[model samples]
Target: MAANTDETTDAELVAEIARQVPDASADEAAAIAVAIGAHLTDRQRAAAAAAAAAGSEETWDGKEWSFSGRIDATQKRHVRVRQESPTDPWSAAGRTDRM
Candidate 1:
């Protein structure tokens, strides 16, 4: 689901989550929303980390190419990442370094 986290307040998240689980108590709904939100936040962080792992950047250079991702070292974690403009001539020519 596309979301603007900056505009998604905690209470709003709780309310939305409660709406999804109508049977849950207010406290239960809030808790579920908090947990779910945290997971989603972590997922985003992991993906961002993967894109920035090589350095403090979200791209390969001052060009159209770009990369971003994250790696979750936690017990339940897995790989998450993204690379843009893979069809660029430089990429097609095969560069040795990986972002």
Candidate 2:
């Protein structure tokens, strides 16, 4: 099951990321957690708008968005996001990569 992003704090996100990726340093985990938190927040808003405007029979094309940021002095993380776009069933809000 996915963690509920609504109630998750930055510290909690960092902890969860650490648990999921034991090899990442503390700073790396924290960076990735923050990025994930932002992604989830944006997706939640899009889902709400889609719910309001979407038809029951609507079908979305598969899409994935990568959220990238500097994790540390030596490395970075790229998060691949996939979900239904708001109001538009053919593309994501910012960027689109076919999944």
Candidate 3:
């Protein structure tokens, strides 16, 4: 029997196994494929949940920091916030001759 972690598709693996064991019934092969797929799906879901719970924060150039927010399907494309100072380089460019 092939190792479970070989990364072969369930259908490919089932066909290979059936070729090797001609006595195995189609129902048995199908059952094995369904079981393996379910196990892999459950493991993937658990891993994703754990990763989301361990949220990470990052800073750029040791000066600016950014945070990630979860957006649902109904949320707007952009969220607006007021800043004390303008952050647009184009707007600030006309005010100063530097650069």
Q: Can you list the residue pairs that collide in candidate 2?
A: none
User: lDDT score, residue 91, model 3?
Assistant: 45
TM-score of each: 0.42, 0.40, 0.40
- Local distance difference test values of all predictions, in order: 0.55, 0.56, 0.49
lDDT of 1 by residue, 23-99 (tens): 99888886677667777878999998987885654453543322222213222334223345353545633432332
Clash count per candidate: 7, 0, 0
TM-score of 2: 0.40
Q: Per-residue lDDT for 7-65 in model 3, tens only?
A: 54567878876787688887677556666776877899899988887664322232211
Query: RMSD per prediction, one decimal?
Result: 16.8, 22.5, 14.1
Model 2, 1-99: lDDT tens digits are 235545545787788899999999998897787677778778998998888886564443332222222212223444434444443532333342332
Candidate 3 pairs with clashing backbones: none
Cα-lDDT of candidate 3: 0.49
Winner by lDDT between candidate 3 and candidate 1 = 1
After superposing candidate 1, which stretches have Cα over 4 Å from the reference? 1-9, 54-99
Among the numbered candidates, top TM-score falls to 1
